[model samples]
Target: MPIAHIHVLAGHPRPVLKQLLREASAAFAQALDAPPERLQVWITEVDPELYAIAGEPADEVLARTPRAQAEIPLIRMALMEGRSTETLHRVMAALSATTARVLGGDPQRVRVQIDHVHPDRWAIGGVPASQARAAELARRAAGQGG
Candidate 1:
């Protein structure tokens, strides 16, 4: 299964996130050769205070720049459980291309982060773990989360 974990700031509206998510899932499904249902994607929409862009303060950057109106701090992570690193890169490339247009921003600005996690180490709908670590993908695992 290819799991894609996405963490985005709450600055954008719901629809944009939805678009990116759908595209991301499709990207993973195609790249990893996994079924849509088997491809797991977890999205964490954090408050602006909780997210940062390129190491810049979220609120400050948003407040000072007009890009904030159309641009959001986005972090996309793809996990290739039982897959190859080459496949993960291809997935990220597709995700960035589709997501930038979906979110209405320069495609170059979107950031992609991919990491691996264990099924037992992740949790959702409950305090499975700290938010910091809750956003990783695992291989050879059941569904704890993405």
Candidate 2:
């Protein structure tokens, strides 16, 4: 499951958060080739002036008419194995683009991080617990097994 925690200072409308949740969930589902029901997302609106911008303080960013700063930390995890680096890169691009478009953030300043996950984090349809990170860990462990 993918959970995007958008920790921005409180002040934004509720619809915005809802929209974010929808977009994030869809993005993750498509990115991992999973069904929409298989994804989960969370939007956390932090207090204003909590997150900083650039090297300066976030209060400065809040001083603007928007009066709110948003820090979108998105994490999409999938049990699928064998995703190429290029594929991951494109996913990042699409995610960032969509987030920027939806949330009205500076695309240049936006950031997105991708990770391979263990499916165990989710027990789909009462399936047994599993680790989405299993294969990745195994690969890394074997690489360093020596």
Q: What TM-score, computed on C-alpha atoms, does each candidate reach?
A: 0.64, 0.63
Stretches of candidate 1 off by over 4 Å are: 53-56, 68-82, 117-146
Best by lDDT: 1
Highest TM-score, which number? 1
Q: What is the lDDT, from 0 to 100, of the residue 69 in candidate 2? A: 36
Task: Estimate the overall C-alpha local distance difference test score of candidate 1.
Answer: 0.63
